[model samples]
Target: MLMIRPSFDTLYEALLTRDPSYEGRAFVCVSSTGIFCRLTCPARKPKPENCTFHETVAECMAAGFRPCKRCRPTMPEASADPVVKPLVEALEKRPGHRWGEPDLVRMGLDPSTVRRAFKRHFGMTFLEMARQRRLQEGFSALADGGKVIDAQITAGFESPSAFREAFAKILGQAPGAFSSKPLLFADWVATPLGPMIAVTDRTQLHLLEFLDRKAFPAEFRKLQTYARGEIGFGRTDVSDQIQAELDRFFSGTGASFETKIALHGTAFTRDVWRELIGIPAGEIRSYSEIARSLGRPQAVRAVARANGANQIALVIPCHRVIGADGSLTGYGGGLWRKQRLIELEQGYRAKG
Candidate 1:
């Protein structure tokens, strides 16, 4: 996916032009109006200097802006399109069916257009998404220690090979090869920002990361090694603890996270992450400050690299790091989320 930092001028021009290409892909925040609107919003445009563009609605909300009333910016335009609603309803009705191009054509919809529509709205094609839904069910089944074959059957795969292929593609491992000893388990937890994958064993939490983060795969691999097992879906007491803590954290009720975390990093990296947690809520720190805290002021670049390698999100508090100039910098969870997390923590601190 292209990651362009939209400027105020560029966003204003896109809003003026009413670019359909930027419809779901971009959003604009009007500082003067205290509202954020989609690029296609029909509301009166704000001055260029008062406008800010963001990639997601969560970002705008994090920045203390409400959605535009006239544009209803939170809802995607394709959701209001004529054909998509029915198509989505049909898919929901028969989730067990293996959706494909033939199914779309049979429904009197052009396959390519349908595919594009689904991608534009959901970030994945219909078939890929259907497969994901099936796999999610299978993962839930496996949580209860169900047999591999049972999971395949539950997922509606006709053949074992196809089931294995699908399972491997998603979780990086085959079904039968998954460990039964139950060392550490991973499960998806939905958040206001987005869905996050949380992994834990009986003792401590291992990984908690945004599903769409660019470093997700690497984090998964590292977690697999740390847990000494294949990644699979299940829930444990630790998972429940982490989830509850996260709920409180995001709801702005509390910043205290009791989920015991096992850090896998070089000595230097671990040191940097330790200092990251020391940063109080509603406070910001720079890489140089972190390096200095570690008694190695010259290792600013090293500190930044270690911060990027953090697998655990809110628990580790890597979002508190900013550039030396006090500008937001690269964050694997997306800059918008980083901004929101900072704002959320700041609000909590203020309340205290």
Candidate 2:
């Protein structure tokens, strides 16, 4: 059933409508996301230009696209495994239930059997998933200005010591070690590309970057040092303001950022960032070009270094900088995301 050169128009229509007739008959691969899904997948559809049709799951996989979690194209059916679904449902019904072996036994479930099923399908025990949920809640509590004790209780930990131990294990520090004043709160914002961390205070956004960037943790440590250890986990008015603006920008209803930024860098680096902001959306420049504009033609290497050191993504528009011959250069965020971003800006600019 793996056919080549199928009508793009017909499959595109099926994808838009979630046509059941095409559920097992076709798949859609999104070049921007590197993901494949059944025609009936319920996730937000990518733009038509980003889509490619495949007649079989094998063909999709051959093209290097991973099966989407929402559609589960690699599975025998979309319902997921029979054993794992009920366990997942139970965890969802009481995500804060504090799971244990005894609780599984009381629910007419076998502890070993449940563990095997979850491990086989999800690569972790159901209890581990629940614990992660608890930890995430604790993290959210801290980010929302809750005290250490309040965060511990909110995360379902029975004692302060236990909560601190868990938090320290993950973040390499005790929660109380971070200062409460002049806080640079860390929070996560989800976009069509992926989750990004936003660090900010009441006055200005301090840092924003994609989670998968190799230098992200280092950047956070640098910020903590620069802020004189005043960095804590949480949100601020600046974060909320940026979140709304990012939503508008991604949805194509807005084209620019207006939030104030508190940058930590030398004079040259700060100047380079300001130059980045001056490039209009959907346009680009080379490092040599930027250096010339800055009247530092001999400092092209410095200009390139400054571009790579940029901490604030999107708002600073670093993705607009490319190689001299019109190819993409190294982007801190993955190159695919950079390509998708350029395409997005170009599409929006074309509409205007």
Q: Largest TM-score belongs to which candidate?
A: 1
- Work out the TM-score per prediction: 0.67, 0.64
lDDT of all predictions, in order shown? 0.74, 0.75
Worst-scoring 10-residue span by lDDT in model 1: 57-66
Clash pairs, model 1 backbone: none
Model 1 over residues 112-191: C-alpha lDDT tens digits? Answer: 88778766765556676566556555765676678988888777788989988976655556777667765778776545
Cα-lDDT of candidate 2:
0.75
Which runs in model 2 stand beyond 4 Å of their true positions?
1-81, 94-135, 147-174
Q: Superposing all C-alpha atoms, what RMSD in Å does each candidate have to the true structure?
A: 10.9, 8.4
**Which portions of model 1 show Cα errors greater than 4 Å?**
1-89, 110-132, 153-166, 230-232
